[model samples]
Target: MIKYIEKLVKKLKTSEKGQGMVEYALIIAFVAAIAIVALNNGLGQAVKDAFTGASNMVTSASNAAGTWATHKDT
Candidate 1:
């Protein structure tokens, strides 16, 4: 049993599968960290503000279009 455990440990240490998985996990963790920092530091607010501005513009344009449609040029 000990020999089998040691063999398994050695195999795991020499395996590329585990290395690849660890590399991918590290990459995911790094990207997640970056995203968290970006969203926490005004990036989130900026995005929200942009969306709000766009919505306001669309609302204004729609109201104007409705008014123009109702008040056709004679």
Candidate 2:
């Protein structure tokens, strides 16, 4: 049993599988970072535009509601 345990420890210490997995993980992380940066640079304006449109819609709706409320009470 001791010899078997020693062999297992040696195997674990010499394994290169973990290193390959770590390399893959790093590559994926780098790709994800690049994607985020690209989106920030490329799509940032589009996102801002969308938010502005939404704000305009909200303002219009509020104004309509106010007009209706004022007229209903008269």
- Root-mean-square deviation (CA) per prediction: 2.1, 5.5
C-alpha RMSD between model 2 and the true structure: 5.5
Q: Write the per-residue lDDT of candidate 2 for residues 8-69, one digit (tens) a residue.
A: 99999999868988999999999999879978896878888999999999999999999999
Give the top-scoring candidate (TM-score).
1
Which digits, one per residue and each the tens of the lDDT, describe model 1 over residues 1-74? 99999999999888787777889999999999999999999999999999999999999999999999889963
The regions of model 2 sitting more than 4 angstroms off are 1-35
Question: What are the Cα lDDT values of the candidates?
Answer: 0.95, 0.93
**Local lDDT at 33 for model 1:** 100
lDDT of model 2 at position 18: 84
Global lDDT of model 2? 0.93
